[model samples]
Target: AEVCYVGVTSSAPSSVARTPEQFTQKLDAFAQKRADVHGQPVSTHTIVSPDPIADLDDDLIKAIKEVGADLVVMPTHPPKNLDVIMPSHGGKVATHTNVSVFLVRPRDG
Candidate 1:
């Protein structure tokens, strides 16, 4: 299967001091490394928006549609409060997108 990594970044000025080009280069390097390890070609796309974090699912859905992806695999973290019904970014994406979504939770310490 082919691999495409999409990275979203902020368009608004930030204190992080990293240029969009630098961020894109970092994403490319990381994607290349993963591609090398997986022994497959990996393409990368970087999206610069005013508030990618707030619209995470939107960006993800857009990228998936643009790439014509049938499935999406993304990392997700557990909610801080179990009582809250707030959906995670992955959950929001899954609900909004037409493709299958695979959410992987990271191992806790």
Candidate 2:
């Protein structure tokens, strides 16, 4: 059973209180729901980060390294402006990290 680390990073100002706690609460609710459906073997972790959510390639790489994760599976939302120089965050993470990244594009409804 592969362990999945679900990360939600917030770019909110540092003065905000209970931000991480709120994130944890949300994650706990989500995990509980999934656990109820999937039974005990469903392994998932919630990583609540206070740093900026976008373009934190180095931080992502470092964290995954600490956990000995060889692969990073992420979803790429369609970019609002296609002309932006840098690719998606997942793309940048691919080039910069010492790990492998798998990216999936969400289909528009």
Predicted structure with the largest TM-score when compared to the true one: 1
User: Which residue pairs of candidate 1 clash?
Assistant: none
Candidate 1 lDDT tens digits, 47-85: 887787777778888899899888899998866785267
lDDT of candidate 2 over 47-94, digit per residue (tens): 545565543665676667667777898888877687287677787778
Q: Which residue pairs clash within candidate 2?
A: none
Q: Which stretches of candidate 1 lie over 4 Å from their true place?
A: 12-17, 80-85
Listed in order, each prediction's TM-score against the native is 0.86, 0.65
Task: Show model 2 residue runs off by greater than 4 Å.
Answer: 11-18, 40-51, 78-84
User: Candidate 1 lDDT (Cα, whole model)?
Assistant: 0.83
Cα TM-score of candidate 2: 0.65
